[model samples]
Target: MLRSLCTPSLRLICKPTTRCRLYSTPAVPKKPNHALGVQNVKPWSELSTPQKVVVASKTTVNVGVILAGVALTGTIVYYIGSELFGSDSATSVFSDAVDKIRKHEELVAILGEPVKGHGEPSRNSRRRNRRITSQVVEDANNEPHMFMRFYVEGPENQGTVMLEMIKNEQKKWEYKQLYVDVPGQGLPSKRIYIERK
Candidate 1:
């Protein structure tokens, strides 16, 4: 048994050798056009109508929102500026004070030192000219301090009035120099400076 294990067996050496091979079809060459891997690109004009509409609507909405934001920001700035810088905002405040003072009998009686001007307003008031023409003249120099001139077709203050008013420490306008430059209703242009007596 030791000799048989050490030596090769004659039956095993007589076996025939067999070889195995794998066969496959050759790969075909790719098309010349596909070799570069070009992609289809469409121009903007070639886009469908629905796609164009969607793009246009998006643009319009974005622009509208931006415009609305600008307007709102402007309004807020104006409000804040009017309050903070009340000096230049005298037109509204002074005009309103004039109106309020006129409505009060006690305050109107306190008005003193009237003005005398008779020549058809001198045709000098830019307000009178622009108002009659219904046109606006951007001339701040034309308007005087605390002076409001506008045209109305009713029996309002027909003539010019110069008023001397002072705002108290409490932000209240006190009638100081409330004199009419041009008196309305053919009333006296100059009023006697009333003494407290």
Candidate 2:
């Protein structure tokens, strides 16, 4: 049995293959290809007219959108700055009136010290969100006039301030009427005239 197994093993080991085929070709080294290489770019001069038009349109649209955004931002900033800090704006007028009210002896005595000014009252507890009501209208003489109303509060009492202004020939705001009305205090709702036309 050992001789038979050895004989078969020797024969198998000594056997040679009669048929064989080569499946691989010779190896050849090649340079790597980059997707974004300068060699891959097509110059503007080489582009067709239609392709050029498309590119031009895209650039114009992008620039137009950017310019529009900048203009809108500038307009909004100018409006807010002028409204809040301009010398002739309603907010400036309100601040000036409040200062005068604070200096008045009668109002200070009745309303107490450290008076605060704010917009109209609302249902919300946060008064900061309240907006001051104001309007611009033309009078019978076709002159522009502004009317505004707000509230002022102190430790003792609160009152509503009414103001009216007219645009003068020099394009300046001139106070026509300014007053504070304190109601429900068992006193006459006397319109305290702070300014006259």
Candidate 3:
């Protein structure tokens, strides 16, 4: 029994493997006001249009109304998509997620390093019984994946950092895979695969 308990724990160090990081991606700045889910998409055929015209204007108006409606609907759908998934064409999720984890300062300190990036968050990791904020999404290459960055309070009272990214939709942040600069962990970070404490 003493031998089993006294066995040295294996210490495995993971290397960072991507160009993204907590402070490198462009995510929305933490804001007092924020946008959440989808809005609305109105159909075009229901719009008001003249029944008769001088040169078959009814068809033209109908077509025009349909197109306009489509455009409007498309815009709404896109907005909702981005909100649910992530920003359509920006990198801000990192910043947002980091902020939520409560290690903003540590993440910021690592940003100045020249060789830093996000890593995989552990599978079942936790700190102080709190859930870590995580998200997984593909890189700019359109790959399907995610990278979860976890923040925990260590025994020394310092912040503990870990990252993980999974391609499965079962993971979090499947929609938004972008990164954001934060002030928690160092740059060139990787994800971990631990469980909740």
Candidate 4:
């Protein structure tokens, strides 16, 4: 067992072969000859002042172009996202409902009544608090419905005029109901009925 673990004799190890010369050579780095004249061989740190400035300027311009391209792409993405999600365009359901209500001759004539303090805001500026406020919600039938209230304070002092409109299959809005209570009187004077022809 001891003989099996021991190294072989020097006579067996001393055999001459091509493999013996592999380890005899020492690795040495070859020096580059300056006589061939490599044009860009000089390190950046060893370059003349003008040469270094030219390299640095080119690097700065390339970096600037890359940064500008990223900024422009980011700006385009932000604008597209804003227009897609944030705009109240005519195609939007809520905006369509509001536009229809605003253009209604009957509703506009009622709400557009000139109030006493309306022109007084901002020293006769037209930017008065609007009389109408509205919201849209889906009913039990999953149909779009608009609920709106108008504050009409004139000679009659009409408090809050409630209007409810539902969208039909023809892409048109029809009034569902309307309620307007008399200012001094406790109960509504009349009930509005919406009957389709």
Q: Which candidate is the best by TM-score?
A: 2
Screening candidate 4 with a backbone cut-off below 3 angstroms (N, C-alpha, C), the clashing residue pairs are none
Relative to the true structure, how large is the alpha-carbon lDDT of every model?
Answer: 0.44, 0.80, 0.43, 0.52
Give a tens-digit lDDT track for model 2, residues 1-197.
11112331232222134433223334557565676463555789999999899989999999999999999999999999998999888789888889988998787777788999888788878556678888999989899988999988899988889988998889898889988887658867655667877
User: Which candidate's lDDT is highest?
Assistant: 2
After superposition, candidate 3 runs with Cα above 4 Å error? 1-73, 76-92, 100-143, 146-164, 168-171, 174-197
Each candidate's root-mean-square deviation in Å?
23.9, 11.0, 36.3, 19.6
lDDT of 3 at 178: 28
TM-scores for all predictions: 0.28, 0.68, 0.25, 0.33
- On residues 1-197, what C-alpha lDDT tens digit does candidate 1 reach at each position? 11111222221122135433233445567555655786564676997999789878989999999999999999999998885565535444444544644564433443432311222233566543232111122335452223333311113343343444444566554444443343434556533321111
Q: Which sections of candidate 1 miss by over 4 Å?
A: 1-77, 80-88, 94-157, 183-189, 192-197
In model 1, what are the clashing residue pairs, if there are any? 160-182, 163-177, 164-177, 164-178
Residue 69 error, candidate 4, Å: 17
In angstroms, the error of model 4 at 138 is 0.9
